[model samples]
Target: MNGRLLTGYVLRRLGQALVVLWGAITLSFLIVQLTPGDPARLMVMGGEGGDAGAANEEQLAQVRADMGLDQPVILQYLGYLGRVVTFDWGTAYSQQRQSVTDVIGQGIGSTLELGAVSLLLMTALGIVFALGSVLLPTAWLRSAFQGVTVIGIAVPSFVLAIALLQIFSFQLGWFPAFGADGLRSVLLPSITIALLGAGTLSQVFARSIREVSAEGYVEVARARGLSPAQVVLRHVLRNASLPVYTIVGMLVGGIVSGAAIIETIFGRPGIGNLYVEAVSARDFPLIQALIVLTGGIYVLVTLIVDLSYPLIDPRVVSPAARRTR
Candidate 1:
C-alpha cells in the first residue's frame, strides 16, 4: 500500500471506531434508563426490595435525587458522555458507592489475565485445526478436525463451561471448578472461552487457506522453485490471514459476552461477574461503564485488525484501490 493509503485507512478506521463507541454508549444509557427497574428503589432498599406498598413519596424522591435519577434522560446521557470522556465512571450503587473505575480496576487484572490466556489458546487451536483440516494426510483426520470445529461452533460457552466443570473438575478432579486464584484456576475458563472462538475461527480460517491455495500467486511462488511449505506459509498463509484477522476482531466481542457467562459460571471475580451484579441490582453507572468499556475494547481490536491488514499484505489495500475509492 502507498503511505497515503495506509494513513487514510488508519484515519478512516479511527473515525469509525469513535462512531461505534458513541453508539454503544448511547444504547447502553438508553437500555439502563428505559428499563423498568428503579435503581433508586433498589438503593433505598439496600440492593434488595422491601414493602413497595409502604414507601413514602418523599423517601423515593430523595433516593432518586441522590443517584441523579431525577434528571432528564437526555441531560443524564449527555452528562454521562462527558464523564466517560473524562474517564470518570463515578460510583457503583450496588457496591455501596464505590468508584466504578476502582471496582472495575480490582477485577480487571483477573479479566486481562483470562483474556490474554484465552486469546493465545484460541489462536493456537484455530491455526492448528485449520491447517490440519487442510493438510492432514488422512480424510478421517481432516473430518475429525472439522467435526470438532462444528461442535465447538454449535455449543454455547456456558454449556461448555458446565460440561468441562463436570468432567474435569467434578469427575477427574484435574482442575478447580470455580474461582480465579492461580494459574490452575485460570486454565479451565480460558479453555472455555478459547474453544468458543476457535470453533468459529477455525472454519473460516480453513476456508481462507483453501481459497488462497488456488490463487495465481501461489502457483507463481511454486513455479519459482519455492517448496510446497514455503508457498503455503509465506504466500498462501499471509494472504489468507486477512479473513482470519477479521474473525479475531469479531472474537473479542464473543469472548467478552462469553466471559460474562463463563465468569459467573466459574465464580471468577472479573468485570463479567461485576456486570452481572450491576445488572441484577440495576446499578445504572456501573452498567453503562461496563458496556462502554467492553464496546470500546471491541472497537479498538477491530481497528487494530483493520490497520494491520496493509502491513501484513499491502496488496489488500493497494494505491489502486484507494484511487478507485
Candidate 2:
C-alpha cells in the first residue's frame, strides 16, 4: 500500500512540476516582452552599452524583422514553444549569432562543475558535523557548533566570497581566486558555497538526532545497558539520518543558484556569473532560458526529494486509497 502511494506521489509531483515549468516559461516570455528595452538592441553589443553604433532606422528595422522581432507576440511565443518542445532552442538574444543550445552548453559545464563540487564538500562536512555533534560529549561544544552553523546561515555568499578572495588571493597568496581551471581552482569557491549548506544541514541533522534520541524506543536502548556508541550508531543516528537525507537534493538547487553570486564575485566563467552579466544587459532570451533551466532543475530535485520521503518514513507513504495510485 505504501509503495502504491509512493508511486502515485511521484507521478503527481512530476505532473505538477510540468505545470510549473509551463507557467514559468509563459511568465518569462511576458515579462521579457513587456519590459522597456529592445532585446535585440541589448544583444547586438557588449560591455556596458558603450556603442549603439550608427545603423540607420531601415537597417535596425530590417534586423528586427530578420530576427522575427516584428512578428506578433503570440505567434512568436508559439514558434518559441514549438522549438522548445523539439529541444531546438535557437540562438540567444545576447549572443545573437550563437545558437541557444550552444550558449547554454558553453556555460553550463562550468556552473555544474561549481555546484557539484560544492555539494560534495557540503554534504561531507554537514553530515560529519551532525554525526559528531550527536556523539560528542560536551553540551557547551554542541552549543558552540550550533551557534557557528547559525552564523553561516545568516551571512551572504558574496560577503564570504570577497573575504576569502582577500585572504587567499591577496594576503596568503595561496589558491588563485578566479579562473576555475582545475581542482585547485575549485577549492576556495566550493568551500564558500559548502559553508552555507554545512550550517543549514548541520542544524537540521542535530535537531533530528536530538529528537530521535528522545523517542521512547531510544530509552529502551539505554535500559538494555548498551554502550553509548552502540546506542547512537545502532539506533539513534539511523532514524535521525532518514529525514536529513531528503535535504540533500533540495540544497543542490540552492547551491547551484548561490554559485552564481559566488562565481561572479570571484570572476569565474561559470553559468551563474554569465547570468549576472546577461541580466544586466537585459538579454531577455538568455535570462528567460536560464530561469527556465534553473526552475526546472529545482523542480526536478524537489520531486526526487519528495519521492525519497517514503524511504525515510513509511508514514509518508500513507495507505489511504485516495493516496495510492
lDDT of 2 by residue, 31-61 (tens): 6577666655655553235365643467557
How accurate locally, in lDDT, is each candidate? 0.83, 0.76
What are the C-alpha RMSDs, in order, of all predicted structures?
Answer: 2.5, 3.2
Against the hidden reference, what TM-scores do the models get?
A: 0.91, 0.86
lDDT of 1: 0.83
Clashing pairs in 2: 90-100
Report the backbone clash tally of model 2. Answer: 1
Query: Candidate 2: deviation at residue 130, Å?
Result: 2.1
Model 1, residue 292: distance off in Å is 0.8
CA lDDT of 13 in candidate 1? 81
The residue ranges of model 2 lying beyond 4 angstroms of the native Cα positions read 1-3, 42-73, 319-325
